[model samples]
Target: MFKQLIPIALIAVCTPALAAEPMVVQVKRLSLDTALKIAQGSIAACREKGIQIGVTVVDRDGTVQVTLRDTIAAPITVPISEQKARTAVNFNAATSAMKDRANSPIGRIDGLVMSAGGVPILVGGSALAGGVGVSGAPAGETDEECALAGVAKVQEDLDLAM
Candidate 1:
């Protein structure tokens, strides 16, 4: 009887340990307000340079959060901005860093714009929050700078949240 009780108690004690871990995990998400702020910041930066531009902000999953295009910006800039943002999020790096990959097979993948206009938005220095893409600047580097400015707009908030 004692042996039987011991086995039962051991089973009960180990059951919790054997149980499956949580099926879902909590993930940080970019808020709409923050996304809008990023987009506006990017546009403002470009405007300062007398460049009409389009800006897109996408979440970590490469989903568009907010897109803004200046009235005089070319219509083509909208799609290009989105592609740039998606590329940044998909590659988890700034598009400028991946410029060498532009002619590679990986870059040939649809929606992956391996240009310099895309910048990743990182939180707490490590967490990938999202990405920003700017288009219509004379140079890709300039577009990237605008994107960086947009990310910088909320950088302090992001760091503090962490």
Candidate 2:
């Protein structure tokens, strides 16, 4: 019984050591110029809709990539755009999805924002980069439309392989 117990203990101790390491997927990085272009496209889309908006892009880690605040945009729109961009990168989902989840109990956490205008930059099904965020628009859908348009521009510009 003692020998059997010793073997069991050894097996338990060695099991964790033999376990495989967690897989880490590397996300592709978007160049600063490309990030700016994406933001610009988003702004253009909003402008075409007659909306004065602030656009912000962030990296996958939620760091600011480019920020474009229109001259006529509301002051609050600046931070709101940044918040939406951060929300998208942090959550790895579009701002619209974040908004939907925000209405849920779990979304009430201290640092989450669920507003629209945030979109994730994805490549090959992997969230390799971040996306454009538009604010100073009347509705979430309007903001989302602009953001999606911006993403489309980036996709078209790069002719993304994905």
Q: Which candidate tops TM-score?
A: 1
Ten-residue segment with the worst summed lDDT in candidate 2? Answer: 153-162
- lDDT, candidate 2, 11-106, per-residue tens: 999988767555685557778988888888888998998899998888888788899988798988877888888888787888787666787886
What are the lDDT figures for the candidates, one per model?
A: 0.93, 0.80
Task: Give the least accurate 10-residue stretch of model 1, judged by summed lDDT.
Answer: 18-27
Error of 1 at 126 (Å): 0.8
Superposition error at 75 for model 1 (Å): 0.6
Compose the digit string of candidate 1's lDDT tens values, residues 14-78.
98987757868777989999999999999999999999999999999999999999999999999
What residue pairs clash in candidate 2, if any at all? Answer: none
* TM per prediction: 0.87, 0.78
